[model samples]
Target: MKGLVGNMGIAHLRYPTAGSSANSEAQPFYVNSPYGVVLAHNGNLVNAEKLKVHLDQDVHRHINTDSDSELLLNVFAAELEKKGKVRVNDEDIFTALEGVYKLCVGGYACVGMLAGYSLIGFRDPHGIRPLVFGTRTKADGAKDYMLSSESVVLKAQGFTEWRDILPGEAVIIPKDTMTPVFKQVTQPLSYSPDIFEYVYFARPDSVIDGISVYRSHLAMGDMLAENIAKRFGGRETLSDFIDVVIPVPDTARNAALQCAVNLDLPYREGFVKNRYIGRTFIMPNQKERKSSVRRKLNAMGLEFKGKNVLLVDDSIVRGTTSKEIVQMAREAGAKKVYFASCAPAIRYNHIYGIDLADTRALVGYGRNNQEIADVIGADDVIYQELDDLVKSVLASGNNDKITGFEVGVFTGEYITGVEAGYFKHLENLREYNARFKQNSILAGDDPKAEVDIGIYNEGDY
Candidate 1:
């Protein structure tokens, strides 16, 4: 199976940790005291500190890593062993995980049972990241259920049909049984972008919760070009200007194409990424991650030198990679380097999947445009406005779907400064409280929504 699926074929239960990038951090980390457990997990636990405290003090188990996913696996596995005893069934294990965690903190993930016969899955109360599943018919005429971070994996393996798993819902995948059962964990908080999905995490041809990531990105690319050109108004010269184009890296490829078509400028590739380092998670320290970006992207100095280069990126969370690439472009003798992000100010921390840590760690958090500009070292930095952000993605009929984050957050205009600071408290709420916030944030006409009616159909998908 490992040979068949390569990376995707490896499961939480059976895979080994040797020769892996994160060997100590590998999945299916085992425990002996808790009924000989093995675990693999996705997502972060908001209350991980508290859970750790409880686990050490009460359960007498000491945690070894900083990952909330591992901590969560330990806690839940302990709970299962304690409650299930020797004869505990899959139903009992699922029920045990309920009230103990009202919030999975800020992540969406799945856990496979190593000692038991069931695979358990859960999402953050809000559908932050995406999880897709489908049933595949084997050559033997058997239908097998599969779950993954994206449907692209299924398609790559020749499984064309798939559907998204709803947020806050837990589905039980039985090992020997043909049928799967679901138990709603809690109501979904509200939908937020997995953060990474739009920028650098997911594959290009992926869909999350019914929205096409590719289409959403094309809008971002086009909007980014408009915003950047609008900001760098001084570059009106015919020759000094390199015109609108993408650098051929992951962040700006789609948007660059759209930017070129929209601006009627000749689009060309400026930088080529070494595909070897595809996508990796954003870590806490910006200093440590900058070198990795160079290992991933090399500037086409010949193409960009003496050109007023416009660099379009998906987002600039820590701005480390963007800073390096811009410096590389400038050192290569580019006339000027302009930077623009498809995302608006990512000023707040993502409690959802992006695994982006606290706002205090973000280069853009609490800082205005000027500070962010200096940090990223761009000649100019332009971001899509929050209102334009929603318009670019959600369009018309899809306006009210994101119940967790307020539409007002996307627009960046809070009507009041007090309301503007609301996201600081978003990470601390429980599932029920988070749901309440999503339900209460809106009550008026969102005059800004311009959903694309063409994307909405009555029935056939």
Candidate 2:
């Protein structure tokens, strides 16, 4: 730890999508050639497999791991080497980054250090992810620059001036200097940012792409209340039908409070969440997720007994947690449980970064509201309308130049074009993984008996 001294340093926390969670898959991948570059990435690359092939055959670079971040580092390094310069400068970095943008497809927000020279940050052309830039001035007349995935980090660090990095743009902050040079390296393919960031991932206080996460949740609650009223008559009927409105836990608190207020229904903390337990949606597998849901939340019998209760969650990806919570409420003596999702139904895979990757895994995919409600054991399931979600999230009417947030999961319109053969590849991979999982389960159940395995590993199957 003592050896970590540097004029500038960058760090990252990654949730793996393309690769397994081995120690070798960690980020801030370094490439020490031409001019050394250390980089960390935030989003998934849709064209990573294709890029890996190009890197091997054309770029002549060897990738050690399956991580897209490693491939990205090699791509950036090759760009710098193309200049054939002993020492690299901002122009070389900019030119190299432009090449990287052209070669890569899918969401990315990256920050890196150019050896001992500069700190660099860039966002994908589509701006599918977020990147914010902040600057702080010291009494000694020196300025410091920072870039992060969200603005909350800058605010926490007491940065006085901050703004978002535009799509298709790159910024370079030279070492030991406060001044930052900015350039637009590529034309934006589309300005569609991920709406799920505001819906689920980002901190409540964060402002992503000019929308307040907390306020967005409030608007979602308002819209949800509106939808409930339209579907089930007035507050007089709702008050009798739903005795109390309860949030799933911390993330749904804002929406729950506002929903209760708008519906004229009582609001209570029905579930006491154990914060130490990680979010089940991000859990590695179904086994871990199921176990964690039980550990994470406990129902209050007093709140549920003899009363029809309404439960609210930010979104339902797999529905495992939702089903468990509904069963818990029933066990607690609740007369009936009505579940509402603040976000629209996730009917398509999120190729960007939110981890609802498999179509078959999504509970709402190819299912109606009644079918979904039955599957989750809710009396009725309610989801925010896609149009209403878009309106609520972009409530302030700011950023008129931009159209709206990416609604791929709800509308099935991929803002960035989906490749021709990608879906088939994903399905094949899913089938292989399913076989591997089945084989492992069978082996665990009967160790002494010989089992016929169709295919052994992940890819071979």
Candidate 3:
């Protein structure tokens, strides 16, 4: 990567949701049929199995990996092949993308390279995932273009004037002309971005679809503060019930700080996070997640000693990490531990890109607030109201397009409508992966094995 020099390229850090963590499944997936194209995708495809069959039977393209990104790459390549032209133009590429939109059903944002021709980026019809692009002016007055999932990256790299790619829109930047062409390939079904982006996934510094993630979290804190006050009878009595507001470090820090300020309570960092550990929520299996909690964070006895501490977290999907953290707080000499979530209880599986957990495995699935508290060993549990959470995001953004958010994890109602039988498919995939991982552990084999790679070049495009 350090030595590679290219005028146009696409890159991806694989966050496994659709397939196993095999090295072969890593992106940028390539296809060479009609015109050489490589693509890296974010988010999952609900109709991937159906598309796989279509690609195999109709398009006659052999899929080598289980990754849906690879499937997507092939889908685009197959559509381009239908053009039946040796040299394709922007219109041809966009028409192919229209074909992709007609077939693929799910949330996705993709960046692709059409060999030496152009750099392409597009988003799903519902705008369930994020995609943005920006430009920088060079010394020679030629503009350089970049695309990313987050605006923060563009801004950090001096790519000013960034804006989100609209729902169902595609942008193509030609290498020869250095000009970008934008088109709405499909009519948008809706303008809902995933609410989890503001709650957890995205960095606080990022502004997505005109909404500031940091501000939204602060608004979430204000909303949760009101709820917390109501729980203790009144704002005046908040300090009587809770001594300090301690965030489950990192993601919840902004919300916790604001909540403490609103409640007029002391804000303390009760847990010290180990910067080296990866996020536990996105870990592949339950066993790894459970074991990593302690390694990721340690309780600070000074902040918890003999105090009634209130813990704030982004959301609680499975009770594993929260339960362990509660025990840690108690051991750190906290008198009583009360837990609060800035987001509402996630009872449903996140079907988009985030692999939360199985529906039945979720702590909030069939449990009330009290039951959730008991499971997590907290004296009480406070969850943000669904309406309040939605309001928090809406109030922070000026985007008229974002009328609502994809709150499937809380309401079990996805913006893309329900994917019938998708849950069972997801459950089976998780089970198989878990079993494979366990077997690998028993056999003393590495679950993630490397694969060979080769380069191909056609005589002259």
Candidate 4:
């Protein structure tokens, strides 16, 4: 990417949600028509399958990949084509975005570049995804614009003046003028950013939708401490029950530390994380995820031996990692292992963007607190209450506009109401992918094989 030279460009690191993990499915997806536009999208579109059909039949646009991002790019292009303009302008781009908002449904934040014309950014009507932009003035007084899913990127690159792009809003920065035009292309349904951002996905340093991620984690810890105290009978009995608080690794560290401070328990780095190992929860298969947990973190005997240790993690998804970590703690001579999740039990599939396990595959699904504890081989399991989790995020920032959050994983009710049969469709896709992976392993094929299982395309039908 460093070798590529361009004054104005958009980039993306694909986290597979609505498509295959094939290299071809990666963004920034491009469309040659309607003035050579390229786009990078941050969230999943629930209506992608319907949109694909509309593009193919109504607009005559051919989609190459199974990616919804490609569908999104072509959607905007088709809308721009409707203008019948020889040369497009900022207004046309925003009008195209209005079409996109109307046609596409679900949580998405997008950044697009119109060839030799403009850079564009927009968000879903519900604001279930995060998008922010910032500007820096060049020495000649021309302003350089940047758009990202997080504020940290803008600040890191010295774009000091920044603000979140509002829900249902679009921003167009023309290359010729270098001036950005902002507009609310559609009426916002709600101002609900995904709560999972604070729990797992985002960097602690980044602020999303005016809420500081770091501060939210601290608040989560405070809430978790209160919950833990209740579990231990009272706040005064917390020290009697728990010997040490140990964070699972990087993401849980902040909350764990704050939890320890609130509970007056000693916080210890009980597990040494191997920085090279990628996050195990997002791993494609259960087998890989199960194996990677051991490689990712090693339990220190000194911290666990003869002690009643409380393990803190951001969240327990499939319980593969948590179960292994608990076993490791026991092997390290811990007398008792009490597991704590900073977020509530994630029982439903996260259709927004984060590719959590299927609903049935989740540890929390069809399980009470004790059942979950038994599955994870812990003495007890503590989950953050949904209300407390919401409060934790709300306590941190300018949350006046945010009346709620996209918490489908916890509640099974989404901001954009789920379409009929979508959950079944999503489950089928996941099962197919899992089977494909198993077959690849048996046949000794590349694990990352480019096998398309017809997720968002016409093939699914």
Candidate 5:
């Protein structure tokens, strides 16, 4: 391993948001094209089917996999091939990327090696996902630039100066030059970085698009606190309604603290999290998610024995986990249970890169506050408002760079345009997979059964 050598190399983790877990579908997907490119991307192409057709018919290229990242790589390759150069410079790369921005839709933050030529990176025009850039100087005083989906990596790796690569911006490091050049390939359009990154996806220590993720989470708590207060009169009346503020654990801790502070309630660790359990939200199927949820947290009966507990979570997607937690609270002898969400209701599918493809599976879909509370077995439910989410994040700083965020799941208006029938396509896929998942759960069989239309998982395609 120590003997491995290259001018530059890229490593990527495929989270399966838009592809299968097969080894063949893993990324840093390599392509022998205009200059021989190896590309890795963190996003899902909403128009991948259309792009595949275009690539085959218009560009005369073939996509070997159903992975959207592969389609994006081929698109980039085809565009570069159009430049009629075996080896190209930054200008050619940006021109080719402009073609990508025009034809492809949904979120993408891409990084790649242009063979022996250059290291290239770019983000979608709307910045639905995140990419941060950093620079460091070697002992000899030559500078090296790094790009990643999170800033914590750059910080951990000793990069001196780091910042977000803006939406529609491209950074190129030519093999010969070694100096990284930044180019705005597309117009400086309105940016709508995904709000969920701040809420769930990113590490709390990270900073995305110039906003500190930890602070954003804390601010979300602050907003949740404010909303909670308004729902139950002023802060003075909160204690009468709620005895203690509790977090679902890990992600919701910061927000829970803020909620407790604003409402003048005692903050308590009412639920003991089993750190060994993986996140239920990212699990592939309903059975895994439900099983993980049941095993992931244990109620502290001492805390909930006679208290009215208000539980805070980053978001409520399916509500299955919330119901389990609420039942745990009840079993622990709690007089009442209240649930609060730092994010608004998730009612629509996210075409960007998240695996939440079925609107029907969302607990908050078509349900009002009281209805959501009823479904989750909570005495009351509170969710952060859309405007407050924007305000809280903006207040953290960088009001100039990020004027707003993509609340597409909550608002159902994709920042990037979606073609007609896209929702229908997603629903059909999710329904097909849901049947298989349901059968697996009922039979207590292996959960990885395949559906008929499965090029991959329901959300990926």
Candidate 6:
């Protein structure tokens, strides 16, 4: 609050994966007006493109990025300007922005406004993304409220003791008053975070929807060891030597350690990350996939040489990266390789916000586990059961139950009828109906995924 800066400052970085792969498309767009509102968003907005179209025509706003924050700021600034006032109340801003969104389907979003009369913060109802807030009192006795997609970012800046913001809830902070206003924008949509995210994307240190990301993977690793034992009970074959549990780079480290503990085997980091490669799962097509592998993964000669190793990873979506990695491991003089998936088959594509599209493009879409193992060149593969998945990722205790949105519906046991013809942000789908015909690559019932990043081609992984 006090001594913050000349005009307030906010920073944002993009982890662009599941969609396009351009830095120009990154986030943290700023107003820089006397208003000086700097906006950053973490997750996807199902309707941001639509909102952009609305802003372009109705408000004459041009978007710098394909993100919801840009669309939102345009709407807020336009609405405020339309009201012909230098400042607008929080209620007035939220009332104008509402759209259909989901959690398990992806897209957790956070919005912040600095150098404005009042700062507003919000999260998707399903909380598909993560956001945390902290407050500091300035020398001038003004309150400074800060928000980030991850709490540790603020913690690194000396912000601590954060509380989770419920989905669909918005908090308004004013300079003159320490008092805050809370408003509900829409209903809760999805689960806190996908179980796979803990096994992969999120930092193990984070708490997603109250679930400890690291701890859950530890449990998954343990479960996987048990599954492996059951699969190869009393075999004692060359492949059953059980030399060491090798993790697939960063995401599987925690789970690999846990698997070692569960199976009483040694653990080691067998693959080194490129440190410069982006997640190919987030980018579209096979070019990024090849580049990501060449730039992202390397074999650990010492850990893999002439040894029968168990390679553990969070999930194998395209089977491209994992396949290449496995081949490299074999070339590293490994006697045998066994692969394990910490979660069950990702057959269904995520409609939320993640990059996973539909079943057609999914390597495991029409294939079974053994088939996937063959494709990826692993000697054996095992996966955690779905029930155990929810149990492990969501904290277990009378008080540690999982709730934020109806994640049970995620299994497709219950379906939220898809809303169509009204989406604003997603383009290239006007031909999704009646005109769409199935080709060799587009053979599926899902219309949304008939094209690139089509929802139907995205397998569960």
lDDT of 4 by residue, 1-461 (tens): 67888789988985668666777677888878878989999888887778877988899888776577888889899999999988987778878788888899888999989889888899998898899989988789878889998899988998889999999999998887888899999988999999999899999999999999999999999999999999999987787789999999999999999999999999999999999999888899778998999899998899999999999999999999999999999999999999999999989999988778779999999999999999999999999999999999999998698869989899988889877777776775666566665664435322333633232433444
Against the correct fold, how does model 5 do in TM-score?
0.91
Write candidate 6's Cα lDDT for 1-461 as tens digits.
57677444566666542233334435556666436665666655444545655766676665544345556556655555554656666666565334323221235566666564666677766565667677666679666667666665666766655666667767777655746677777776543544555656677776655667778888888777778877777334423577888888778888889888877788888788878777777555566686688678888799989898888888777787778888888998888888888867666555444545444556667778889889889887777777766667765222243453223222432123233432322333322321333232255534333123311212353
Q: Candidate 2, residues 1-461: lDDT per residue as tens digits?
A: 45998768898876646544446567788878867789998887778778878987798887766567788889998988899988877898999999999898888899999888999999999888999999888899778789999989999998988888888999999875647999999988878889898889899988878878899999999999999887788766877688999999988899989999999999999999898997787666788888899999999999999999999999988999999999999999999999999998898988776556588889989999999999999999999998888888889437664666778888788877776676665555444444544555444331212222122222332
Q: What is the number of residue pairs that collide in model 4?
A: 0
Better of 4 and 5 by TM-score: 4
Scored by lDDT, model 6 comes in at: 0.62
- For residue 106, give model 5's deviation from the true position in Å: 1.5
Q: What is the full ranking by TM-score, best candidate first?
A: 3, 4, 2, 5, 6, 1
Quote the lDDT for 196 in model 2.
90
The RMSD of every model to the true structure, in order and in angstroms, is 13.6, 5.1, 4.2, 3.1, 4.4, 8.1
Local distance difference test, each candidate: 0.60, 0.84, 0.89, 0.88, 0.83, 0.62
Query: Per-residue lDDT tens digits of candidate 1, residues 402-459?
Result: 5533322233322112222234433333222323324543343121112221222222
Candidate 5 residue 198 C-alpha distance from true site, Å:
1.1
TM-score of each: 0.75, 0.92, 0.95, 0.94, 0.91, 0.75
Q: State how far residue 121 of model 3 sits from its true place (Å).
A: 0.3
The stretch of ten residues in a row with the least summed lDDT in candidate 6 is 449-458
Residue 456 lDDT, candidate 4, scale 0-100 = 43
Which regions of candidate 5 are displaced past 4 Å?
1-3, 428-461
lDDT of 3 by residue, 180-261 (tens): 9999999999999999999999999999999999999999999999999999999867778888999998999999999999
